[model samples]
Target chain A: MTEFTLRSNLDAMYTVFLARVRILSRYRGWFLMDIILPIFLAAMPILLGRAVAGTSMEGNFLKNVGTANYVAYMVIGANLFMVVSNSLWHFGFWLRNEMQMGTLESLYLAPVNKIIILGGVAMYTTLRSLISFFLAFTLGCFIFRVNPFQGDIGIAFLFLLVGLIPVYGLSFLYGSLVLKLKEAEALINIGQWVIGFLMGIFFPVTVFPRILRFIAEIFPPTWMNNGVRSALLGLNYFLGEWYLDLAVLWAFCIIMPLAGYYVFISIEKSIKKNEGVGKF
Target chain B: MFEDVESFYAMCKKQLIYMARYPINFITSFAIVFIIILMVILATTLFIGKEETNYSFNAIAIYGMILFMFLSDTLWTIGYNIRWEQVQGTLEALYLTPASKFASLISRVTISIVWTGLNCIAAVIFVYYVFGALPFKNLIFSTIVLILTLSGTFGFGFCFAAFTLYLKESANLAANVLQFVFMILCAMFFPFSVLPDSVLKISKLIPLSYGVDLFRSSLMGYPEGFPELLPVNQEFLIILLFGIITPALGYLLYRKAEKKVRTDGSLGMY
Candidate 1:
């Protein structure tokens, strides 16, 4: 392979980034609706808690969950889940959209590498997810009248920042499968709900069975959720220390992205050999 | 009429044969859908476990969700499959045939229904063996309920298919919206009781809920003192009503849309 130039790669990334921002701007209402949807989804549980537990809301919640601030806890989980959900949508479904619109083959014909284009896509998605997360988290706090940035804000951001690497990595793995299968919409639609469940978006992973808990822990989103909750709501960290948990995510950051990229490239090569990317 | 019937059957058989040639397509769709159903079953189990104080999803509740899922998988197939055919340039060729367009369209739906039924059969077998034999106490009643449920789904599918005739590219969007409606209104994963009072009331007005309830009554056994739940027999009445309502509207809309496409000369424009 030839030596890669950083400048050219950055330019390619920026080009892909601009394309995404422009497309997102076209569907402006849908983008805004996503930021609002998670808040409503989280509100149900908070209101239900208040209704069912009445005056003992804090006591009842703290008794089992070890957090008096169930509102903040659920908000963090939901917002983080929104990030996981949207990132997968961005990378996974975007490929399918391109294929459908006859753009995937066009991208394949370009001199620039697929990884550069994917890098740009990932950058755009991360930016959008962070914006949505902040909005939803802030608005949820305002609606529920709870402290949103109470616990270890810096550490929580660190976890989010690291957690995204593996999450996107896994998303690329899913994207490859979508490419091979050609059932992107159905897969993503069902996959999102399954992710929500496994990540314990509305409840703690501690509530899951032992086997389920083990599986959930392996998922990057579950770690992100727990880390955020631990940071914001003062919940117990899985590793019992903030640094240890962050370290695990950091390790995943190194391992998963490489593995995911390998899997995706292998699949793309095999596909190109047989039907070719243009077949879609 | 007899000639049309024969040609429709021929079209259906031809479509089936063409699909069978691509065994991977059918197998993968079946596997992906089965995995999705399995995930829903797990999620439903978790939701029920949180409240029910019992670990088991009664035969009715499980079957109800399974049926809705199966229907949801199939109902939208017509629109999406048509859209794919249109993309492949085969749809225009199909229209150019001597067969009645309505018969050809319905035949496409028949092909999809058969494929979905095969998938459902696989799922049912998986459930029976993996989850153990569900006590389906009223076998004959359950079959009637299943038939009604299938009819109601076909009704919704027809209404959706009409939209595909107008906006070819928007077929995927229509399918997504339909699936969302099934999840929200049908209350497949949770009881209607858990939903907001307003949502619950409106859900009852949708025929899919009655279909779900019918399956629940047959498979899970009717819940104690829950008069609001649609009985198996009552579901038959609702299904009959929807069977008339949706297909009539669907056929009308489809005819109007098809005519407009013909007049505008835009069928192959996309």
Candidate 2:
């Protein structure tokens, strides 16, 4: 057997990443759908606004959301939703697919650390999601006649980059649920929508009831969403300052992945001990 | 005729049993629709304000949403579900059985109507309580429009199943794309007046767009600027034709594709 070293582990991770990327490349239409669906999602609310509020849509939106640029706000929200949704889906579905294919057992027996393999998958998901987010945001802005270059693009990038870690951490937790329940599609579907709703995909969390707003504020995507929108569209951050809200996200960045990984590993070990990974 | 009816009943029972095996699927599907409706309402309220009671807007959105749910469920359960059977290695086995294929295809519609129908009723009730009173005008006509719209949608679903057989792996992506396309083209969540003139022109071209317009407009009691695509009589005529003709045409297309796949020995090649 080959000696397990850092170099070999790095190579294994790269192989896994490359394999996922290659598979995704074959499904070219999914990439296009990723780009198009966010725009469509943002359009639903925008059109509804036009239908209801008519000429005063922007004024009402400004009064409620603190940004007259509802287009950018929604585009940003939808793209960030895509990010969070994709992370949950790719990770959970990856696990479920492995289980179904009877490969999770073999993966467990592999010499490389499971976290390393997961890290590889997480990296691929992040790359795919960010690419889709950028393309969709740009396209949605153009389609809605909103200027894409309006705000602190650098800080917006910082928030997005910082926000992804916790989102993936949430995905790890979701993957653990998939392992335990063995019903990944329904779980991921509900998980994505729940996250989207809590994160205020098309509206400000301030519109939510007090308890709902509090619940929404705890999810990292909410901060990430407000961060990007505030940076781009001049909306106020949750904590009144960009850095303050980002610092909270930083706290999540540290806590969520650790908690998620611990829960995932615990569930994984329990499942392995009881029914084995290949049982699906 | 009796045997075909029995086969459809058995097939529906089998599908329901599979659904029962996954209780979470049923529960989450119910919850997801509510969450989605709430999100849309919250978003709309952001612009219209929470204080304003716009019953017409509520009626339009809710009714449009009901049809959308049926159409979406039909697309997935009836159309894309054949892809599931193909993946599970049961498509070929299913073909080997002596049961009627048309019955098997149509049986899936039972779940869409039953489950999605329940979800729609709950959604209307949920909206009524939360958003205040919604218009329920011309209920008898609205019901007829709904039934006709669903029959036409199921026919479209059959056509999509044929496309799935032809497209194979790409069918999943196609379904996702088509769902959104229909959402926009049909203006399922918004008034047709909000759609650009260009898009409205395209929306007028699709038969389902008429279904969406006439159903909601009649429910809304034909408010000004309602049924934005064509006159009510003309739109209903289109829906009538769509309901009467599309199922036979779609079934013929499905049978043609089914024969080609079986002959090419690719029925199980998912």
Per-candidate TM equals: 0.79, 0.98
Which stretches in model 1 have alpha-carbon errors above 4 Å? A1-8, A25-82, A96-105, A131-157, A176-216, A232-234, A266-276, B2-60, B118-133, B227-236
Cα lDDT of all candidates, in order?
Answer: 0.73, 0.89
Candidate 1 per-residue C-alpha lDDT over A137-224 given as tens digits, one digit per residue, 9 for 90 to 100: 8888897687865879999999899999998998888888888877665566667767887888777778777998899888888888
DockQ of each: 0.10, 0.88
Q: What is the C-alpha RMSD of each candidate to the true structure, in Å?
A: 4.9, 1.2
lDDT by residue (B1-270, candidate 1, tens digit) is 998999999988987997776555665566665554554444333323133333234353456556766567555665666667777777778778777876766787787676777776787677778656766556777777677667666656666766776767657655655675666567665556556787788888888787776666655556563324565467678877875676677667767777787688866555
Q: Largest TM-score belongs to which candidate?
A: 2
